[model samples]
Target chain A: MEFSYEVKDSYAEVKADGRLNMVSAPKLREFVTDVIAGGSSRIVVNLENTAFMDSSGLGALIGCLKAARQAGGDLRIAAVQPQVKMVLELTSMDRVLNAYASADEAFGND
Target chain B: MTEVLAERSFRGLAEAEAIESVHDELDGLWNDAPFVEAMDQMTFTTAVIESASNIVQHALPAEAQRPVELGVDISVRSTLLQARVSAFYAKPPLGQLEPGTPDEDSESGRGLALIEALVTTVTFERQDGTNIWILSKSPQA
Candidate 1:
């Protein structure tokens, strides 16, 4: 998996492409944590290209969400593919992650 | 006897990288058997990867100085998909095999329940120091 971020006006948009499995879960958490530490608490993880995700990957996302909230901000995901959406719903994490239609909409109206 | 239309097998050291390799194998397996329904393929792949990931994360070596190896055998039949995910050279799992209902805030402990929900049936067995999880799913008609 590969991670890149752009600090938008209201939030940092992190694009994660490729499989979000156990192999890359920790890296994701670290990447998002660094983004939050860099002072952008409101985050939007773009998963448009993330084709796959396991429980480990879901856990990493939850961890990142908590980190953002602790920093007085928020984290949301957008463009979730079918497989990721299935995992989130099955594990009941979808209610907490709060998926949006796009990165722009994630922090929109906030 | 069941006729397997497509199958994939992988065995390697139970490490983080092995998960990716197994996932690659699953992707190939789907290519080999595109006749399988999309939902069946999706659900079965998730269950297999979850089982394999559990081994890598928790399975311990049965003997000192020996590393645990992950083994996966997945097959697609006319109407069913199955996977045997194993932990080679591993000791018996210590905790409950049952899935837990973790609160929404928890990050882990959801893999087991997710697997149960995805597949039709899940069973475990131990033989010759290897622990195996059998996950099977019946394709939608």
Candidate 2:
């Protein structure tokens, strides 16, 4: 998976473009950590460009979210495609993590 | 970035990490309007990715740095989605594929079990040191 990051007004938006599964899960975690370490407290994960997710990837995301929260920040999701939304719902993560219709919306820009 | 447009061939076990993203990726694919109400494609995609990861993390961990090839294809026929994942890797240890004894809290032994549960059928074939896994699923109609 290819990851692109950009700072948007008040959030560090990370766009993950590609599939996230067993192999790329670590990279996602590491990248998110790197971003967190870089001092971006509020993180907005743009899943609009991502096409897949698995148990491992889900675990990684949850791990990151927990970490980010513990560090006094939050990991919010934006533009999660419907299919992806199903899994999140199945796992009940949609309730735990706030999902937004768009990146700006996730940041409460509305 | 391996853009999986319709279908894509993943060349090696090193890409196994990418399989971890199957849940979300397949979701995105199935999110297309035509599949708005079901998870047929999502199930198949997850199965394939889990199977592929098993081969990479276990079957070829020793030879991981060596060239191990993987090919993936996805298609829908008769309201069913099929995912064919063919891979090349060093054969696993004699008992490695025979399920594991991980604690309930562990994730090590879940890959194969998960794949089996997701896919309607799974066929494994090994020829010339290449392992081919054809995983197919027909989600509830």
Highest-TM-score candidate: 1
DockQ of each: 0.88, 0.16
Q: What TM-score, over all chains together, does every model reach?
A: 0.98, 0.62
Local accuracy of candidate 2 as per-residue lDDT tens digits, A16-53? 88776776678888998989898986899999987777
Worst 10 residues of 1 chain A by lDDT: A86-95
For model 2, how big is the CA root-mean-square deviation? 7.0
Q: After aligning candidate 2 to the native by TM-score, how far in Å is the CA of B105 from where it should be?
A: 11
Which CAPRI category fits model 2? incorrect
| Candidate 2 deviant stretches above 4 angstroms | A107-110, B1-39, B60-117, B121-134, B139-141
- Residue B66, model 2, lDDT: 71
lDDT of 1 by residue, A1-89 (tens): 99999999999999999999998999999999999988999999999999999999999999999999999999999999999999999
**Tens-digit lDDT string for candidate 2 (B1-141):** 233334433453446544544434455556542442355555666677777666556565327567665556565555455666666656534454554443422323555666666678887777777667777665476
Q: With candidate 2 superimposed using the best TM-score fit, by how many Å does residue A40's alpha carbon deviate from the native?
A: 1.5
